[model samples]
Target: MKQQILFSFSLFLLTFSSFYYPINTASTAPASSPKLAPAPKSPSPASSKPLVPTLPDTSDSTTPDDITKILKKAKTFAILTRLLKTTEIVDNLNSQLITAKSGGLTIFAPDDSAFSNLKPGFLNSLNENKKIELLQFHILPQFVDSNNFDSLSNPVETVAGKDPLKLPFNVESLGNSVNISTGVVNATVTGVVYQDNKLAIYRLDKVLLPLDFFPSKVHASAPVAAKAPKADDHKDKSSSAEDNEDGETTQGQKKSGAVSFITIEGTRTMLVSLGVAFVAVAMI
Candidate 1:
């Protein structure tokens, strides 16, 4: 009976040992294998942002030529327009009209009839730089109507005159009429040729000659006058011969060397002068 009990116990022990320690299978993973990295997350729909606002566009708006268009319509202002063109201030005027932080522009323009009274060849006598200064004299960088005269701080300098020191201008207002003085010539506002918030144009019977250009007096002795004729005659004879000899040379040189500054109004002072004369004749 003891032998039978021992044999049964031994069989049960063997079966338990085989079940606990089974043989390794081919599909089993190794303990030392490297782990895979996680995938990157996609951007969310809520991450999109709105577009930023931009500045106002001025590309299609009114330009500086708008002033010229208005000025060209007025026949009496032909001389002023011509001078402005000569100095290349028409473009500057247009630019300042747009860019000026303070007053846009104020122009005290003289009529063709006013220029007609000047000494012959007066305009022709001036050099290029003098012509620019002359044109600059007529312009007040800030826009001022006749009503703003009393408020203006004088001696208000101009854009041209302000380089070394301000080309000073004085304004005095009485009733509806305004008088402007440049310490040399006095001009009264005869009419308002053009007026806007950005610009003001006042017609003057006389040109506003800056003290920078013209003097109040000229001093010459009688002897100098007598001697001038002989010297001038000598200069003229020599100049004529030199002109004939150097005409071609100077012409080509002037064409090549001289900086050509044409204006937006076209280079036609002679034509403008003729137009002014035509208008004046028609008025007569």
Candidate 2:
């Protein structure tokens, strides 16, 4: 009976200890395993900006105002433009403008109507040198504005030279009106075509006819008329016979042929025809 009680007490103690302590399932997990990290996210297309193109810079580019271009654009100076080209004064004026530092040009530009008002055969009567001089006579080497006419003295020098007896001209200002006298005809400044500090162009009512061109105004003394020489009755018939025998003209015959050659009138007519044709073609 004492042995059975001792064994029963020992078994009770063992059951009581097992019931007080429980088995841990989390502690049984593997300690060697590592934790995994989450994946990174991609960026959205809506967050980006668009690219733009750049433009070119052209702030400093500018063109010059040429004389011919100005006249051409004006449309009334067509005949004058043709004359300028024909005389090559356009090239000379452009070059002068480029080379001259302080000097500029003032032109009394005659319009097509002014040219039309000229007497017939007047332009045709001028030789090539005279034609150039005629154009030059209308120009002043220095620029003169319409307001400054009062400041100028009489006998204003021109590109054609200011000879008191010949090419001398006078500029008179009455209020706002300007009158130019060449001792042959008086021309009024009708209007201002173009004006800059460097260049000045004025509209003229008529072409400036220099005093040298008009003998009536230039010459103070009237000359006596030349008398016709009396014909010689005596003749060298032997020399004439020899020339006729040789079938050649004598000196007298040669002189007669020269007298029958193109006269000033004939030349004037030819030039008038040519000028008419040229003007017609240019207008077309």
Candidate 3:
């Protein structure tokens, strides 16, 4: 009886050990290996460079208010304003001029008097795709006072075309002039007079056009060829010519000629003759 009791106890111990072993093993499993750490963040890409703003080519320093007020009061300017309002290009150009930070732009604004000479369909045609070009023709790349207009050189390039035109002109303060190469026309302002620092207003006899703005069927024209000598070239040529002229006459020769040309009585007849000969030689 003792042996059987001992065997039964042994069997009970074994069954309990089998059931508890699995539970203990699961509890000690190290918490699912601490789940892997998350990946580190990557750095951001670099930014692109910014673009620079370009300045508009102009020289007139008049304020937008001045332009607006003048245009509003003048009959010809009012017509142009109306035309500009209807055209996208012209409207944008006006807006640019108003908002431009750079001062000093010379604008050759046409007035109602200018439109008087246009054919019925001419204004309408300009209102079409050529509005930008028409607006550009009136703008000079530099600032020029009314007094400097007479000194302007030919072939002044305008924003109207890829190439420049030869502006044929003979401007006088009292005379009408047309720089066909530069596509500029100056007309007498007749009754209009400028006051204070304001520009002189004018009623144009005709509307200005770009050299290439017209269609071939209407009036095909070519850009003015560049002809004015470069500054360096002109300087070099002038210096060379002067050097040649100076080298031809030595100090000894000049002194001899002076002695021969002067009379003891102090008459300058020989000197005058020599001067005339020198001038004649220079002309040749």
Candidate 4:
């Protein structure tokens, strides 16, 4: 009876141990594997700056304010901004563009490359008045779109100035392309930046040379077909020509003497003829 009791107690202990062992294993398996880490916090948007400097987009609407805003955003026109600031005309142009019912500005803006391509030190050498004139030359009192340039009259008067004839510019348009000729420089508009009733900005392949600034270059020195010699210079020229002829003759004689003296073929022929003569004399 004691053996039976002990066997029942042992079976009961074995069943309890089996159940507790699996529960302990299930609890320990979770602790053995790695737990995921929390994600790193992102930097604050307010503290971050853009890699490239960019002004706010102002192209959604059109106004004189857009000009200044676009200029600040456009890295291509940085040099143009510097020039406008230097000339102190940025505010004036901006004012004209923003004013109600005022004539807007048509600006032919040359790219940075075009300005750099200009002759070194050419702009720096100009006087203050010439610089102002150059700035004025690029601007027209009215906004002129590229499409209208084809039919536009020659000498489109610019804010720069005008004569009784017409404006300083001769604008020639072919299809979408337009060529601007300032008696001095001929440039084709490569592209348009901004176009509106108030302001139009066109990019040019070259810097427009103002006729007033470059009057000498406008009409090239023509090759004279013939020039009548002045009576006073006639005698002097005649004497100089005769002197040149005499000098040339003297030089020819000197060169002939130098070459003819040491010519091996001529000297050899002469020597051979003399030898034959000596032989004939001996025979005689």
Tell me, by TM-score, which candidate is best: 2
Give candidate 1 regions above 4 Å deviation: 1-64, 162-166, 215-284
* Predicted structure 2: clash tally: 0
The sequence of per-residue lDDT tens digits that candidate 1 reaches over residues 173-214 is 765557777655787777766765777777788877656564
By summed lDDT, the worst window of 10 consecutive residues in model 1 runs over 47-56
Encode model 2's per-residue lDDT on 1-284: one tens digit a residue. Answer: 99999999999998998898766767997787677786678766551222111112211223224677767766787878888888888788877777777769998888889888999889889888888898899999997766677778878999999887889789887765788988778998877776666677777879888878888777753346797754442245665677676666566667777776757668889999999999999999
Query: What C-alpha lDDT values do all the predictions have?
Result: 0.69, 0.76, 0.53, 0.72
lDDT of 3 at 183: 38
lDDT of 1: 0.69
Candidate 3 lDDT over residue span 1-284, tens digit each = 99999999999998888877755766777785567888988878642322112112222344444444555654346777676566544455446555666544555566676777667787666545677667666555445444445555555544554454232222333233333333344443233212213233333445666545444512334545689878999889999998887877676688878887665435676678889999999999
TM-scores, all candidates, are 0.50, 0.54, 0.41, 0.54
- Model 4: which residue pairs collide? 157-167
Candidate 4 whole-model C-alpha lDDT, 0 to 1: 0.72
Alpha carbon deviation, residue 150, candidate 4 (Å): 1.9
Clashes of each: 0, 0, 13, 1
Q: Per-residue alpha-carbon lDDT of model 4 for 1-284, expressed as tens digits?
A: 99999999999999999887766656666656678899899976662211211123434464646465665554677677777888888778887776749667788877788889899998899887877788788888886755566546766888878752222688876545578887667997776676667787777778887765655543353334677878979888988999999999999999998788769678899999999999999999
Flag clash pairs in model 2: none
Candidate 3 runs further than 4 Å off: 1-62, 88-103, 165-203, 215-284
> By lDDT, highest first, what's the ranking?
2, 4, 1, 3
